[model samples]
Target: MKNVFTTLLLFSCLISAPSITAADERVKIIPDVVYGHKFGMALTFDVFQPEKPNGAGVLFMVSGGWYSRWTDPQNMLSWFKPLLDEGFTVFCVRHGSSPKFKIPEVVEDVRRSVRFIRLHAKDYGVDPSRLGVWGGSAGGHLSLVLGTTSDKGKPEAKDKVLQESDRVAAVAAYYPPTDLREFVDEKSPYYQRFPALQFDKELADDFSPLLQVTPDDPPTLLIHGDQDKLVPISHSENIMQQFKEKKVPVELLVIENAAHGFRGDDQTRASQAVVKWFQKHLAKQAD
Candidate 1:
């Protein structure tokens, strides 16, 4: 009887599944476009462009917990629909995963990816100067890095892409660790968790966005949960303060009673905030 019931349920689900067609999908996607080559691997990104673009682009950092992974654009359609609906082209940027490539190398890969995007912005129908970045957690750290550590391209580099600025005009991140060394000390629990990071002042400062903020850094919006334990709220608080001191445009939205990742209505609110942020900072006129 148990087997018969399970078989019937599976059959019902199969028949009840909604039939989806190409026309039903609103956004158009170009998948697995190689943006950079490193470590004998082709670093790629999936691009999702709205039916009508707003002439701006967003590099959505595809990372979490400091371990990089690729997410199918279809799987993230709902999560990114808000941006697409607002007419922004979204690039799902993937980097070399950690434990294989250390955090610093992953940072370099992300920087290279941004340069590639800016170099080919015309082909992607985006204004190179109006690009933005968005991510959370480890991805958020990289997003903050892109915002703060951007520099003029090496004019002498043989690769033309390397000669394009990696700077972005806007950034939005959620619950990101802005400082690494501050989290890992002799008495901290995270000291054992991020062994690859190597708790030293120089390396920490290299990876910590808090140490890199400048007045030229892009307009940034940070949404962090007050109750986040994995990455303390202080990380966002400290960076936001630093941005303020530098006279950079920044905002922090603290979600009350929320943890590392916002849930339910808080998550929805966070997503909405990201859209509004990019709209303000990445607008065509802002460029």
Candidate 2:
């Protein structure tokens, strides 16, 4: 029975289709970096860089449920190995999920993860100036947070890492939840409350990416499925509207029949477009 249980756990960790394992890459925790860990909440991320890098990198967040596993960097090497081959360093971020940890706490952790990475860039062979972020759904919301709520160059306590800005150079999101307060309609099924005692709008509009966009933000690419039932196209549509108004350099990719994570040709193309965006934005750097 012991051996059987072990096998099942390993299988669950490995065969989980959407997960990316970080075992083969650099995996470590920047201790006490989390705002709160009373529920075992902590911030950790995996790093994948070329044996010899050219000078660019990205911090990638996985869209796990607000309460489930989203990525394992060890397995992700197979999917994003091509990017490493092309000389880009990849950071697979892992943060505490909900129920135990609230939604806002997780958001703060994502920002800390990016801030930690940028603070330790030299030790990891990463080029801090070229850092970017990517994700979907919940993770998308985080990427936006890191992009918009940049630290004001102030240190939290004596930790040098906390002083680092969480700002990202660019963003590539797929069917992301651009607005959290308005995400659920009567037709949706996910939990939309922070303990049944709060309205989402009171959660802070600055954290909403679509609402945070300014002329100063970096260029971005938004992709969505027109028929998505989980996160409707309207999320991206409204963001597109906001970007247009500010005249920010934003691009949108709408697929007619695809839903959620793209599969088949659409998936391949989405991956390619992400690589291209990183290369274009991150590569334009100074020594």
TM-score of each: 0.88, 0.80
- Tens-digit lDDT track for model 2 on 91-121? 7776766556656767767777777878888
Question: Candidate 2: where are CA atoms >4 Å away?
Answer: 1-41, 68-72, 183-189, 192-200
For all candidates, what are the clash counts? 0, 8
lDDT string for model 1 (202-269, tens) is: 57787899999988899999999898767789999999999999999999999999877665698789
The C-alpha stretches of model 1 lying farther than 4 A from their native spots are 1-24, 183-188, 199-201
| Clashes, model 2 | 8
Q: Evaluated with TM-score, which candidate comes out highest? A: 1
Question: CA lDDT of each candidate?
Answer: 0.81, 0.66
